[model samples]
Target: MSTPDRLIEATRELLWERGYVGTSPKAIQQHAGAGQGSMYHHFAGKPDLALAAIRRTAEEMRETAGRVLDAPGSAYERISGYLLRERDVLRGCPVGRLTMDPEVVASDALRAPVAETITWLRERLATIVREGLDRGEFTPGIAPDDIAASIVATVQGGYVLARAAGSADAFDAGVRGLLTLLAPPAGTARHTDAVVSHHPAS
Candidate 1:
């Protein structure tokens, strides 16, 4: 990679591993194998480089999510695909993690990408829920935007729950619970029976 690319990638990794306060410019330079002069030459400073890295992460998150959301499937299938997709649960979310950082949340420039990414996800999911309601797949009482927000909340909160417990079971349980709620009444009965049968009364 070029000097700029290297710097941005390194910053991305550092940001993921360490929050904005924890990731230093020196650490970014070392991680990138670029000297101080090269880093400064390519960018104004740490903020500039970090912004680039954050934007890249945000864009990638949107693209990956779109793949699942846009795929050929019913609303439930598409949402489930997204919720159950491969993720480094123990590592938490790359873009969502930034929302926890005080520095990132405090700065408009830094926060914009993260905020936009989440808003986009909520909007996309809401659209799918709306479609399902129109098709009589989802109950009429359920609000698209509300359920969309809850879905995002469930995933993000699942990560927090799993990380706090030091196990992915918490995350899996949360997803399963959300799936149950999302499933139709008949579908929920089958899902419940399946789960009950699999565990076999402990």
Candidate 2:
């Protein structure tokens, strides 16, 4: 890879492993196998490089989530698929992890991508919930934003629980619990036609 690409990749990997507070310019340089001068030649500084890497990961995750959550099926099916799909359960969400780091959360350069990524994901998932409501696939009274936040929280919290407990079972339980909560009642129409409503839409 080119030096800049190498620098970005190294930054992402380091961020995932060490977090923003723990990673240093010298560490990035060493990880990228590039000299300090070369890294500085590309990025203005650690903040600049971190922003680039965070944006890259954000774009990748958005594309990936669109694919998984929009896959052919009822909304529950697609969402459950996304939740249950293969994962490094113990590793946690790289972007979500940054939110827990005080320094990363304080820096606009570092925090913007993390917040935007999560907001984008929540809106995307909410769209699926809205679609399901349209198709009469999910029960009413459930707020799309609330449900979307819950799903994202499950994944984020699942990782924490898994890492803390040193097992994927907690993650599995969290997802399964979500599936149970979202599943529509048997023989029930999920929504009414002509007056379908979830916060009056949008």
Candidate 3:
């Protein structure tokens, strides 16, 4: 990788593993195998480089989510795909984890990408939920925005639960429970057998 790319990538990894306060310029330089002069030449300072790294991570999250959400499937199936998609559960979410860092939260410039990414995810989920309602895949009287917020909460909270227990069981269980709730009642126009069958064992 080029010097700039190396620096940003190193910052991204360190930020995820160590948080904003724990990662330092010297550490980033060493991790990237770039000297101090090179780092300074490529970026303004630590905060600037960290911003670039965070933005890149946020963009990646959006693209990954978009692929699943936009894939060809029933609304419920698309949502199920999102919830069941592979993730590094025990390590927690890269963008979501930043909300816990004091420095990251305190700085508006640093926090913008994290907040934007979350808002985007919630909005995207809400749109899918609306589609499901229109298609009769989900029961009526359910609020799309509310369901969207809950989905986001469940995933982020699941990560916390998994990390705390050092097991993915908690995360898996939460997802299963949510899917069960989301499944349409039996005898509906569309059967839920497919959805139930697709769920990963908890």
Candidate 4:
């Protein structure tokens, strides 16, 4: 890769692992095998480099979710696919992880992409729910915003649960529980015994 590309790749890895505050220009230079002078030649400084990395991460994440949410299927299929997409549940959201960082949250250079990525995701998920309601996939009373919020919450909380328990099983349980809620309402065959059992705990 070119010098700048190498630096951005290095920054991406560092940000995912160490977060914005923990990451340093010297560390990035070392990881990229570029000198301080070389890095500066490519970026004004650390913020410039970090903004590039953060935006790249956001765009990549959005692209991946767009694939799942925009796939060929009914809205239900696409939304569920987007929710259950493979992830390092313990590592949590690359962008959402910023909310926990004082430095990242305080910097518009870092925060804008993160905020936009999440906003886009929730809106996309909510739009799918709206479409599903239009197609009668859900009960009439089911609110699109509520369900969308739940879906986003489940994914976010699932990561926390997995991280707290130090097990993917915890994340699996969370997803199963959320998917159960997204199931069709009661007194119906769609309410499997297992799902019924999960409802009380959820």
TM-score top scorer: 3
Q: For every candidate structure, what is the RMSD over all alpha carbons to the true structure, in angstroms?
A: 3.8, 7.4, 2.0, 4.2
Model 2 misplacement above 4 A: 188-202
Worst 10 residues of 4 by lDDT: 193-202
lDDT agreement of model 1 with the native: 0.87
Per-residue lDDT over 38-131 for candidate 3, one digit per residue giving the tens place of the 0 to 100 score = 9999899999999999999999999999999999988888888899888888889999999999999999999999999999999999999999
Task: Report the lDDT tens digits of candidate 1 across residue range 1-202.
Answer: 8999999999999999999988899999999999999999989999999999999999999999999999997787788778877788988999999999999999999999999999999999999999988876776789999999999999899889989998878888888888778885454223433442342110
Off by over 4 Å in 1: 185-202
TM-scores for candidates 1 onward, in order: 0.92, 0.89, 0.94, 0.89
lDDT of 1 at 191: 40
Residue 65, candidate 3: C-alpha displacement in angstroms: 0.6
User: Model-by-model lDDT, in order?
Assistant: 0.87, 0.82, 0.91, 0.81
Ranking by lDDT: 3, 1, 2, 4
TM-score, prediction 3: 0.94
- Report residue 178 deviation for candidate 3 (angstroms): 0.4
TM-score of 4: 0.89
Backbone N/Cα/C clashes per model:
0, 0, 0, 0
